[model samples]
Target: MLTRDEVFAVLQTVPDPEVPVISVVELGVVRDVDITPDGVTVTMTPTYSGCPAMREMEADVKAALLARGVRNVTVRMTLSPAWTTDWIGEEAREKLRRYGIAPPGRADQGGFVTLTRARPAVACPFCGSTDTVLQSEFGSTACKAIHSCRACGSPFDEFKAL
Candidate 1:
């Protein structure tokens, strides 16, 4: 049987389906890696409650571990603590910026009380400009918001700080 660290190393090979630039480990979704006598169990939290990529991510995790010669892999989805952009690591944030998607701002500022106040300004990933406008709350994915960079005149997605 593979050790927990060994399983995690293999899991690092699995990339997020939506953002192919970073692995799930970088995305901070793989919460826990448990090794058992039978096999391995991966605990994950979805970016959002109804995120479409969660299913694909789970399958990818399974495939990645199995491809690395580990058998009987299992992925468990948990929402007790919920997912937050704060969980995203620094490396993943840089990757998102390089990919033209604005990395999320402080999660503490953006919460379920959006209607109570204005959303925080999202900086442009390409030009590093704070002058940006919200094009739409919904981007290519529910977890992202569409924003246009005023300085660069470019359209980009802002991963919501949830």
Candidate 2:
């Protein structure tokens, strides 16, 4: 009979192996959490089709729950609607910023950008500059892109538009 908040709290500790700053919940990988009479079922979607970290993330979640004395944890992967950055919470975005990665855009921003739309403006994390350019559509991982800040001459990874 655990509350949703309690479940989220336990899940907060399950970090993405690639991005330590954001948890699976923050990355919007987890779509649903259901506590059944037998166990807990966590339904998740991969950020991308070929996400390599998804396996590790799933394991982390189950292990975390087991550690918390909750056995029979089940991690279910779903892909019908796909995972999106819009699902990320505000607090998680702040954590990403603090971790040096540019947070995803909000409403009226690139958070919902499709391929046909123009790219969104990315501010520099080092000097708060808007004159940034995309170094590569793909960054160290499939979920992010490399960006360079013109104002401060600093390069950083920006969470790619979902």
Best by lDDT: 1
Which runs in model 2 stand beyond 4 Å of their true positions? 1-3, 106-117
Residue-by-residue lDDT tens digits, candidate 1, 24-117 = 9988899998887888899999887888999999999998888887778889999968888888888889999999999888677434736345
TM-score, each model?
Answer: 0.93, 0.88
User: Which residue pairs show backbone clashes in model 2?
Assistant: none
- Provide the overall lDDT of each model, using Cα atoms, as 2-decimal numbers: 0.87, 0.82
Span of 10 residues, lowest total lDDT, candidate 1: 108-117
Could you tally the backbone clashes for each prediction?
0, 0
The digit string of per-residue lDDT tens for model 2 on 33-97 reads 99977778899999887899989999999998888877689998989686777788888887877
Cα deviation of 46, candidate 1, in Å: 1.3
Candidate that scores best on TM-score: 1
**lDDT of candidate model 1 versus the reference:** 0.87
Model 1: which residue pairs collide? none
